[model samples]
Target: MQRSDLLYGLIDLFESFWQMAVPLSAQGEPTDDAGPDPTQETRQLLTYLSGGLTDGAIARELGVSERTVARRITRLQEVLGARTRFQLGIQATRHGWI
Candidate 1:
């Protein structure tokens, strides 16, 4: 595999292990999405993701757990019908989400 792809896989593997080590009941910081505007956390996550940061790195930057970063990514993927992070970044840029 390409080095980039291998690094991505390794990041995901480490994130999975981190999540498993943490409590399943641990909750992420609450976000306010009541308005039409995107929450700051969401925007930050997108920015980090667009910059090609791994979930762990993004989580550290956002002061949240990797699981929380993964959850936000899943939500964004569903909202944008994006099958991958690259697609999500493209769609976000198209819609000016980031």
Candidate 2:
């Protein structure tokens, strides 16, 4: 019963979000034009993301707070006009930024 309940709940949640999901082609593009070139520090930070490091790991390597790592990632998302880290990596690669 619990397994079925969890399955049904997930299906319902998927259905709700599916109604609002954008189509695939639109999903590939960035949310906006690539803004100004990111600073060198920003590029370095994103490089760590490319290497599959978590925010805490990045903070440890960079000697900053985890919150600072997160903030830089958020800013990178905005600058690259990406909605997610995966998208950010794609956009940055496309723009030859990283």
Candidate 3:
């Protein structure tokens, strides 16, 4: 075969192998549609909180006020049903957020 044909055949073989190696999971398994939005403050807050940052620090990093950070954290706790930052961290970890 020509060199171009050989490369095309190799590409097809790799595509087949990739398709076989990554099968979809079972249906109705709980997917990750509940996590915080990537472009939102809640996700950033979770990241900072998990990284052991203070609320003031997170506020500064996010370019928002400390009170806003506190309020966002409070809302996040309510959404996750977490009573404390530790609990929020655990939940976020379990949800693959941090």
TM-score of each: 0.61, 0.63, 0.58
Candidate 2 lDDT over residue span 1-98, tens digit each:
24698889999999998775432435455445677777787788879999999999999998999999998889877776567898778778776678
Looking at model 1, the pairs that clash are none
What stretches of model 2 exceed 4 Å from their correct place?
1-33
Q: Residue 93: error of model 2 in Å?
A: 0.8
TM-score of 1: 0.61
Top lDDT prediction, candidate number: 2
In Å, residue 53's CA in model 1 sits off its true spot by 1.0
- TM-score quality measure for candidate 2: 0.63
**Model 2 clash pairs?**
none
Error of 3 at 13 (Å): 63
- State the TM-score for model 3: 0.58
Query: Which of candidates 2 and 3 reaches a greater lDDT?
Result: 2
How much is the lDDT of residue 36 in candidate 2?
76
Tens-digit per-residue lDDT, 42-76, candidate 3: 67788898888998999899999999989988876
Q: Where's the lowest-lDDT run of ten residues in candidate 3?
A: 22-31
